[model samples]
Target: MLAIVSVTSPIFLLIALGFAAVRAGWIPREGALAMGRYALSFALPALLFNTLSQRPLDQIIVPAFLFAYVGGSLIAYALGLTAAAVARRTHPLDNAFFGMGVSMSNSGYLGYALISQILGAEALIAVAMSILTEVLLILPLTLILAELHDRRGRHGLARTLGKVVFQVVRNPIMLAIAAGLLFAALGWRLPALLGRTVDMLAGSAAAVALFAIGGTLAGQRLQHGLGPALAIAAGKLLIHPAAVLLMLFLVPAFDPTLTQAALILSGLPMVTIFPLLAQRYGLGELCASALLITTLLSFFTLNLGLWILGS
Candidate 1:
């Protein structure tokens, strides 16, 4: 347990520093937001492209691992949707967001930071696979459902689907993943200067991303929607990882390291954008509150998960 904490504590410490910087007014809220944007838009994408392109395509593409992760996610999503529909607390329009909150792990930022620390470069294969699954499949499905169920949208279904496609098409992270795979397939390498630049950017990703997340968390408030937030957090921090673990048993086996990566990543809190998306459905505050609680609680859950997996 102490060994696990030794590995995980520094990551949380960075997160805590970000929160402190923002809360103490050392960094303005806008600055924190910009930090997040920088990490997401620049650092992370660069890191993904560099890590992925340098690896062999055979090692990068593991269909069984992808299936297990996605299968686990869908199970959690179904549970969230079922809870939203059956529970008295959640609003009906919140079904999509609720489903999303439980399923969408914070893979881009938090997951990468921790997994890379624990598993080193090998974690990238699982990270890339999970990120691709989240962005390409789960996210689109959630948006489609949100648009279909959300009565406030003036756009037609076709237009909404088209918009979703364009958004995915232009996503920097998605582009990075695609470009990385292409490079790997062709056995291409960047020039020395360019490679150095990518390495520099990649090096900054984990720390900056972790700090940005903490800063973002500092800004969230749980003023209302306490009931729903707790429920969502519980489902996200508890059920999601369990579902993923179960799928690991049912699906075709892969490398144990990749298996551990999948389990750990699945245990992460929901993505930071969860609340922003739920805002369209008038559940922004609820999701934000849920996110805050989930992230806070994940510290212990993550520790326990790592200890268990290691044990």
Candidate 2:
């Protein structure tokens, strides 16, 4: 346990420092947002590209791991949607957003940092795979459902699908993943100077991203829709990981490290963009509250998950 704390403490300490910095007015919320933007738009993508590009193509693609991760996410999403329907009886759009909040883990920021520290460079494959599942499958499905619910059958399916595809392709993270895969497939190596530069940027991603998450949390209020918010957080931190564990048991075999990484990723809080995504449909406050709650709770949940996996 002490060993586990030794591994995990620095991650949360950076987060705590950011939270304190923001709460103390040392850095405004906007400053945090700017840092987050830089992390997302540049640092993370560089890190991902470097991680993926250096690996052999076969090592980077793990089919069983992808299936287990995606299957678990889908099951959790369905459970969340069902719960929302029975409990809240809210608009379908709201339910879709709620379901998304439950299933979408903060893999890029929190999961990547923690898993990379524990599992080393190989963990990046799991991070990349989880991001692919989120970006390509879970995110698009939820957004399309929400859009359809909002539009009320006024829009055509083909157009909606097209728009979603376009948006996913244009995402910076997605582009980086694609480029990295292509580079790996071609057996190309980065020139020494360029590689060093990317390495430097990649090294900054973990701490900056974690600190930015804390800063973001400092701006969120814990009030409003407490009942549903708590439920959503519980689903993300508990049910999601449980589902991943089940999937790992049932699915065809995968690398044990990847299985562990997937479990850790599943146990993370809702993605940092939860509030921003919710804002598109005026569900920001509910999502923000849930994000804050899940993030706080995930400290304990994630530690428990690690112990379970280690055991």
Candidate 3:
């Protein structure tokens, strides 16, 4: 238990520091968001490019991990959506966003930061696989549900999903992945100065991303939506990780390191953009409160998860 705390303490402390800065007005909300954008668009992309470009194709592609993680996430999605459907007579559209909030992990910012601390460079590989599952499967599923519900049979789900795929392909991280794969395939290397620059940027990616997550979560009010918010947070912090762990066991023969990575990633709170995504459906307040609660509670839940995994 002490060892687990030793690994997770610095990570959460930095997050708390970022939260304190924003709430205390040391940094404005917009500035914090800008920090997130810089990390995602610049620092994280650089990191992905470096890791992907240098590693052989076999190391980066883990089919078993994808199957296990995606399957578990969908289980979470189904459960969250079902819970939403049974409560307060919400439209299926709103429920889709609820499902999304349950299923999507904060793979971009928090995932790498948490994993890298525990597993060192192995985080690069683990997080890469986890992000792919979110982008390729979980996100697309949520958008599809929303579109199908909104259009009420006017729009084809397949067509809507295709458009979502195109947009996802153009995401900054996905673009980085593509570029890195191209470089790896061609055996290309950048000039020395450019290489050094990328290395420096990559090094900053984890810390800045973690801080940005904390900043984005600041100032979310915790009233008026406590019931459903608490339910969603509980689902995210407990059911999601348990599902992933179960799926990993059923799948069999995965590397233990990647298996641990899958469990930790699943145990994370929902992506920070969860509220923004729900804002489109008018559920932002609920989602934001849920995000706050889940993140605050994760400090303890994650400790429990680490202990159970090790035990």
Runs of candidate 2 exceeding 4 Å displacement: 151-154
Which of candidates 1 and 3 reaches a greater TM-score?
1
- Write candidate 3's Cα lDDT for 44-160 as tens digits: 889888978888777777788888898899999988999889875688987887788788999778888888878677657778877788887888888778777773454586788
The residue-by-residue lDDT of candidate 1 on 58-147, one tens digit each, is 989998898899999999999998888887654446787888888899998998888888998877788888999899987998888887
Ranking by lDDT: 2, 1, 3
Where in model 3 is the C-alpha error above 4 Å? 151-159
Candidate 1 stretches greater than 4 Å from native? 89-92
User: Which consecutive 10 residues in model 3 have the weakest lDDT in total?
Assistant: 146-155
CA error at residue 30 for candidate 3, angstroms: 0.4
TM-score for model 1?
0.97
TM-score of each: 0.97, 0.96, 0.93
Candidate 3 lDDT at 200 equals 98
Q: Which predicted model would earn the best lDDT?
A: 2
Give, for candidate 2, the lowest lDDT window spanning 10 residues.
147-156
User: How many Å off is the CA of 294 in candidate 1?
Assistant: 0.7
